[model samples]
Target chain A: MQTVQTIITDLKDKPGALLPILHAVQNSLGYVPPEIVPTIAKALNLSRAEVHGVISFYHYFRDHAPGKKTVRICRAESCLAMGGKALESQIKTKLGIDYHETTEDGNYSLEAVYCLGNCACSPAIQIDNDVYGRVTAESFNEILTEQSA
Target chain B: MSITVYVPCDSSAVSLGANRVANAITQEAEKRGVEINVVRNGSRGMYWLEPMVEVATDNGRIAYGAVKTGDVASLFDANFLNGGTHALNLGLTEEIPYLKKQQRLTFARVGITDPVSVEDYVAHDGYRGLKNALSYSQAEIVKHVSDSGLRGRGGAAFPTGIKWNTVLNTPSEQKYIICNADEGDSGTFSDRMIMEGDPLVLIEGMTIAGLAVGATQGYIYLRIEYPHALEILNAAIANATAANYLGENIQGSGKTFHLEVRQGAGAYVCGEETALMESLEGKRGLVRFKPPLPAISGLFGKPTVVNNVISLASVPVILDKGGEFYRDFGMGRSRGTLPLQLAGNLKHAGLVELAFGATLREVLYDFGGGSATGKPIRAVQVGGPLGSYLPESQFDTPLDYEAFAAIWAVLGHGGIVAFDETVDMAQMAKYSMEFCVEESCGKCTPCRIGSTRGYEVMDEIVNKRDLDKNIPLLRSLCDTMLNGSLCAMGGMTPYPVLSALNHFPEDFGIKAA
Candidate 1:
């Protein structure tokens, strides 16, 4: 992990650096640890409450370490209209963990996203950056296997 | 010479397979041993004819739409590069009736310009507003906005000038300008479209706001769902900063306006101004009590001017052409053009930025071309999930803030979602409550607990419970939520529920009293 000093020193002077730092950290180290909030707060001259508030407000910023592969199930209205609930349940059963939880083997992390804007192909899920549309419970296993390897 | 063809790859266009079509065009050109430049531009929001491909020639750009991968070989053979007519003929891209009819002030250069290139943005009247604004006093700029009659496009139609004026009056050493781009509504994708297609316009608009309000920093609270939009914006910001359009001494004017994009967690409540402010400050997106308006004490408790993406996006046009030019376009108090998002079961689901007072029938039948399934139009949910479901009879109602308010309806975000006869109003009404329950922040009592209870009451009434008592109970609960609750999320949740109860009484298996 990059030290807090390095992260702070790099980001502090740049205007609107907090969000960029959060995004960079999340991109580099799967999640933003709570321990680094104070370092960000002190560096940016913001209170820890303020820094912590922003981190928690967005669902994209995860505090906990994700599994090796992360799958974001679409829960947007269009997806929901097309049996996303059943699809979500099926993934949960297969993984043995609920939404926002990681599997025991550290192979999969499941979370819900509002929309991937792939409504035409309804029931979409993004396994990392690649979006798979018209996803089914049966196909999810195949997709997961592909990612796991 | 390399033959250049432009196709849309913005999310909406991509959803329709523009990339596949682009690849096919590239392959066909390659097979012919002809060099090609397939530049992926953004959509003009003529969505029905998506995967729209524009071929550049000496004559200008000619558009062909609904083009498939298989059609590429034929397209290339027809001398499309030389502007020869083909069976997939779309005439001139600008002359398309859907594109021609729209008064796209805020979304002016979206489809026509290259998104990533700063030089292309400048060629199409971009950053002219900031350049024009630098000459005027901040007060003069605020006065110009006051005359434009531009209102917040993010649900509440608050005047932008007054908000800027409030921030201007405040004696603060530091202030901030925040663009609320957390467009969480199911049917509204206009914000995402604007961000992807014309990111520089938004950057320019925010910079103008920053200059006017004496604020040095701006943040666009974009929803996390829009990864593509965020990527486009980040690159656009860096490009702008590199060109001295942003950062210290913008355009060498000695005025600084720096901006950044803040990705929001998938919380619906954060769309509210106060909740959005809380989220910006890095707090849980719970709505705060008013009295301290965001203009007086907002993000980081400094005087802040928070405006919607459309509201700020409209500013550049107002500044350049003068406010009266924009003020002249609309009818009544709802001045200037509105980028109405036509979605759901419509034949033409796209963006139409028209002046206020265009009748709903014109928007539905004329613009939307009726339902996609060729079924009878049952209801159109204007404004989003929280908006009321207007029945067929209300088609005569004009699209204006006052006219909508007359029927207890709001033209929220101008997202008109058409539903066919197949759509069950009861199910949709149930989903409204369910959505509120799912997305509710749980800070207030009526919204937090009431939405869950409302869902149960709705289920009971629809299933087996005594209809007479449950109906009244539902209305009473709606009233409680409308009167109570901190933000519009809970307060406006009852609009869809009540509208369905009033308009589609048959869906509930209850006879009108």
Candidate 2:
């Protein structure tokens, strides 16, 4: 396994390498582990506070591992105009988990994203690497069920 | 002879099942023993017609849209390969009124070419600007841009020429050109469109900037939400590099320019130049105070030219067509076309690239066909989230910088998000402050603390607690944040809050005072 330290080593040569390193760590490990903060700080020659600050400042970086599936729902004005509020409620009800919560079964994790630049096809959602647009409550349920299966 | 079919590789198009539609078409063609050339093109900016497939016919390319996988077989059955009519048929693509009326200067080849094909890009006058630029002195190139009257498309409306001139004049051992692709605004996607559609234009634009400014290195600070764009951009970069359009000694000009794409973590504040630079440095995205402008000292304390994607992408055209050609399009000091993004409740939500001075009424009614919900549009928030919410009474306001300013509003980033009468202005006001709180860099007290206080006050007003007191408090807090904030993130947060309060007082449960 390529450890977080090794990932940091590969990216350390670049300018302003911390964000990329953190992104790499998250991509590889599913989240930036608290245990590796000190390691990253020492490797980058920055304070642990600095590393932690960078990690926490961006909403994309997660401190903990997500569930089997991570779903990001667009919460920006475009989505809001297209009944995104209803869709959010429906998703929460379906998974029994609110934003930033993982399902008890460890099958799903939900997060709110500002915009996905798919405003034309409003009420967009991203599940892992795939983005879906013009999502409805029924369609969302179908997508979740299909992904879970 | 194999018939050519065009399908969008645009991220938003893909999100709407353009990928699946493309796959189904290919599979259907193979199964039917028909030869077809499926070319992945970029979106036409008519997103409502997405998954919009085009067929090259003698009458010009014909379009079929809102396609589904199940419709693919039937499409072939109807002889769609030869521009056959079907239920989804939209006739000739260019003849479509929504796209035909608007001027497409910057996005001339966007949806018209294979984005990764350097040959196809060049065929459509892609490298002409770079070729023209190679012949000119750096000052001449800057002069041409200045004469074009191009302003920054990224909401600020700063003269593109003046900024380039400053960077050209600023002597530095290490100068940088940073293309701010961190388009975090909600209603805009033109940046993403241009990047994914005709990436070579942006590369050519950046290369021109490098040659003009004597910079050898450039970075595109792309937003994290655009994974699809990132993939397309990286591939395009590699293709350009392989073709010697990028890297050292580009096209035998003896000039060296290297370009790299850096991903931004999800932070709206990073769209601001100073904060973007700070974030690019691998630090917290904190907004820096002005004294040493980015043109003088930026990107590792070296003189850097930071421009928005649209601003940079528009350069190739300006260079190719001469500055006066572009300058002839618009009205007043706000010259050149504005690629206005019509989104939210608009019936025909898409990109409308037109010369400046198109009224809000023309955009909303003529181009957009009014609200999608068929209800009366209560408000339209122009220039992204920070822009003011305009009522119908203000619809006659021309989409000019000064015209918008005259109305106490801004034409920031050219994004117009419409909201129907059902929208609650109080809730929108609350979300504005809440978004500020969430995305604020915490560098200044006004934005950091004021946003939270504003949200609380809006909450109280919505909840009908201390309406008389909290209303005045919110206004005062907005004033302080507007005056004391370090950047536009704090300063412009008041635009939405106050506009909502002023325009639609009924939604806030208050009588129009």
Candidate 3:
């Protein structure tokens, strides 16, 4: 596994290197550690404040570690036009966690995304990189069970 | 006998279980001891029949659609490998009514070929435009586009030639061509389709822009939501580079252009050209005030040519078929076709690339097949999140940019999200403001603070608390955001809110104004 220093060292020279660096760190480690902020800032000749600001401003980045699986439900208008809200409530109840909350067992972390570009088949949700469509509450439970099994 | 089969790998098709269908077909073929070849192609945009399987036959590619894993065995038993009778069969892929009825200049090769195959792309007339562009001088190239009357399809509808012309005139040692692939609009997926389905076209388009404007480097700032598109684009880039369609000295022409894909961390505001540049620079996604437009001082303070995915993608066709030939398709100042995405509550939802001037009513009933619930489609939100919501009364309006503007509506990005009669306009209005608040980059006071206040006032309006006061207050706040916000993020947020409040006041507990 490439360490945080190596990721920063590799990407620091690219123009507008901050977002790409943060994405690389997050993608590999699942979260950007606050401790590495100073190191990243030093490599990029940016202040720790500037680096921290960039990390916090974008919704996709996170400073803390997430659960084993992160579930992002689309809450945009297209999803809402379908039964997304109802499905959202069912998932929250099933996992015992609301949006942005992690389950006690760290099995799941819930988040809301605006759109997954599956508008034609609305009420979409993405787990990691895989997006599912026309998902009802019942199907979601089945999908979750299948993935875990 | 070795038979060819196409299973869509387009992300939307995958979302609808295309992958499972693909796996089933392969496994079934092996089980039957039959020689078969499987091609993971892009979508046909007929999503209602997704998991749609096509077989290469004497009558062209026959389509079997909305196929499930359970149905795969039956299909093989029915001799579907030879395009035999099947309950799910939808006839020749090109003959589908929904697909054949409209123009498809920009999306010509999208669902028709292997997304990353350079040879397939060349066979389908992919690089003809770039090759034609290579022969012309930079000014002549710009004039061809200018004469084609291609406007930005990324919602702003700015003339593409004007933006390119400005960048061409500005002398700079370093110039950048940025393709805004950060398509964060809730109801739009045309950009995603082009990237995942025919990425080589975009590569060709960007390469042409680089050659025309004297820029050597180009970047596609794609949103992270499109992980599938990212994968396809990178693969296509590599394939194009290896084929000399991209990278330095293309086909030994001596002109060099390098392309890279930059992933955005999900900021809606970054769709704005200036904010996109700011985010690209590894800073907070904030809007920059423009006196020196992006064409003059952009991307590291050098001349930049920033265009939407559709605008750049359309360039190849304009060049391939002369500008006048391209200009002959649409109405008014809006030239060429727009890849209209029918989403939300619509039945048979998918992408329809049509010439401008089609009435919204014709689209709703003719292409859309009305609402999915079989009820009346009460509202249609054209464009993306910030676009205005038009009631059924306004359905007769043509889709021209100027025509839509006559009613204060915009054909923004050509994404039409329908809502059935059961939808509550008040709730939709509230979500619009809420979306603004969630995605605002907080660069200026009007957008950052105004959106927050707009959301609150909407909450008050929805709750019927101080209705008279709240309604007036919401409008005032919208005024502030419209005039004061630095970019469209803040400026356009009111389009939905006000359009909702004005068009469907009954839902807001008031009579229509």
Task: Looking at model 1 chain B, report the run of 10 residues with the lowest lDDT sum.
Answer: B9-18
DockQ of 2: 0.83
Candidates 1 and 3 compared: the better one by TM-score is 3
Candidate of highest lDDT: 2
Which TM-score value belongs to model 3? Answer: 0.99
Instruction: Give per-residue CA lDDT, model 2, range B303-371, as digits (tens).
Output: 999999999999999999999999999998999999999999989999999999899999999999999
For candidate 2, report its TM-score.
0.99
Candidate order by decreasing DockQ: 3, 2, 1
Predicted structure with the largest DockQ when compared to the true one: 3
Q: Which candidate, 1 or 2, has the higher lDDT?
A: 2
**TM-score for the second chain in candidate 2?**
0.99
Q: Score every model by TM-score.
A: 0.89, 0.99, 0.99
- Per-residue lDDT tens digits for candidate 2, residues A1-149, read 35876898799989999988998888888999988999989888999999999999999999999998899998899889889888988888988998899999898899998988888888899998788888998899888776778
The weakest ten consecutive residues by lDDT in model 2 chain B span B504-513
In model 3, which residue pairs have backbone atoms overlapping below 3 Å? Answer: A16-B281, B49-B66
Model 2: how far is B509 from its true place, Å?
A: 2.3
* lDDT score for residue B65 of model 3: 87
Per-residue lDDT of model 3, residues A1-149, tens digit only: 35887898898888888888888999899999999999888888889999999989999999999998899999998888887788889888988999889999998899999989999999899988888999998889888996788
- Identify the runs in model 2 with alpha carbons over 4 angstroms from their true place: none
Q: Output the lDDT of residue B81, model 1.
A: 80
